[model samples]
Target: MLLADPNNPTGTAVDLDALEQFAQALSPECLLILDQAYCDFADGERAGRGLGLAQRLPNVVVLRTFSKAYALAGMRIGWCAADPEILASLEAVALPFTLTALAQAAALAALDQEAALFAQVQTTVAQRRRVRQELLAMNFEVPPSEANFLWLPLGAGRLVSPSGARGPGSACAA
Candidate 1:
């Protein structure tokens, strides 16, 4: 399965046992493509350390980006972990020079502060909890979010934002 953001507008994370079960079922037959673009915020317990599923499943593919956690949106820097066959397929279809020299350098630089970055993520988690609690107090059907942005299920009030109803395919860019 090609999963982007994994959960949804709900911001909920797939439980570890659930994900592992899903992967184990498909192993040796299908590849589990897990895209964790907004994973840092959703992993409240940091249960996956970002790769819990891929780590345990042989056919699982874990894709991650620096845009969310490391704040490297413009660089388009991300990595995919998969079996050798999938990796080769990806390379074949990937565009040449997909990343600029500067982008490459920046990703390398970001790696130097992994621990500090992780600490910040922990701090962000606390903030998300506070924000969710505050919103819930207002009677909004806000689910506990795992991403930087909260998931306002919106319910019958799905049409939010000052701009009126965002189209089915549109997303809140900010």
Candidate 2:
């Protein structure tokens, strides 16, 4: 099973306690992958839960990326945490030297500036809340979010393309 903690579009997250229970209930043979791509924008405890679960549960694997908070999307660098046995098996079949020297250096640099990056994340979270509040005041049904984007449910409403190319049922240009 694969699940994104802070799900896209909606930005809703499963409760950590509930997630732990669900993981415990699953069959031993079932492998659960928790994608925490946007976790840095979420609350600290919530963001770190996946890694804790991965460390404690043999069947759980947590995947994280530097693309969002670290602004390394172009570098395409990400990582996963799982049991040592599972990691060994993955390493056996994985391509060797997939990470370039430059990417490694960039990732290291990002790590070196972790405090500043996380401060930016906090700022973004505040902005997300402010934007959500504004949308709610405008009568848009914006649900509470823990990620970087807001999800406005426009039922039966026309969609607008980002490039201003109108498709069927589009309302306006970008």
Candidate 3:
């Protein structure tokens, strides 16, 4: 089973308790992959919950990326946390030297600047909240979001042209 903790588009995050319940309910043969790419934008405790689960549960693997909060998208670097045995099996089949030397160096440097990077994350979270609030006030049907972006469900509605004209057959058709 694969789940994004802070799901894309909607940005809703599953709490730790619910995640724990999911891990417990799954069969031992089933591997649960938690994609926490936007975790840094989420609440502090919730951010680390997937890693904790990966450490405690053999069948759980938590995947994180440097692309979003760390601002390292071009480097294409990410990591997975899972049982040692599972990691070893993955390492065995993995192609050698997939990461460029420069990318490795950048990832190391990013780790060294964790405090500043996470402070930026706080700024982003605040902005996300502000944007969501504004969208809500406009009656855009915005859902609660913990990630950097907001999802606006414009069901049956057509986007207005730059000239403020709604096309024929649009929901705004007169």
True-structure RMSD, every candidate? 4.7, 4.0, 5.3
Candidate 3's C-alpha lDDT? 0.88
Model 1: lDDT to the true structure = 0.75
User: What TM-score fits each model?
Assistant: 0.80, 0.88, 0.87
Rank list by TM-score? 2, 3, 1
Residue by residue across 1-174, what tens digits does model 1's lDDT show?
676554666677776667667678774868778878778765645434436566666678888888988899989899987777778988999999889999889999999988988898888888888888999899877876667778776546464556664756455655
Best TM-score goes to which candidate? 2
Name model 2 segments beyond 4 Å from true.
156-174
Candidate 1: stretches off by over 4 Å: 43-52, 156-174
Q: Sort all candidates by lDDT, best to worst.
A: 3, 2, 1
Model 3 alpha-carbon miss at residue 66, Å: 0.4
Clashes of each: 2, 0, 0
lDDT tens digits, residue span 121-148, model 3: 9999999888888887887888888788
* Residue-level lDDT tens digits of model 2 in 1-174: 999989987898999899999999999789899999988888768876899988889999999998999999989899999999889989999998998888888999999997899799989999999998898898889988878888888777544566665676464533
**Residue-level error in angstroms, candidate 3, position 162:** 14
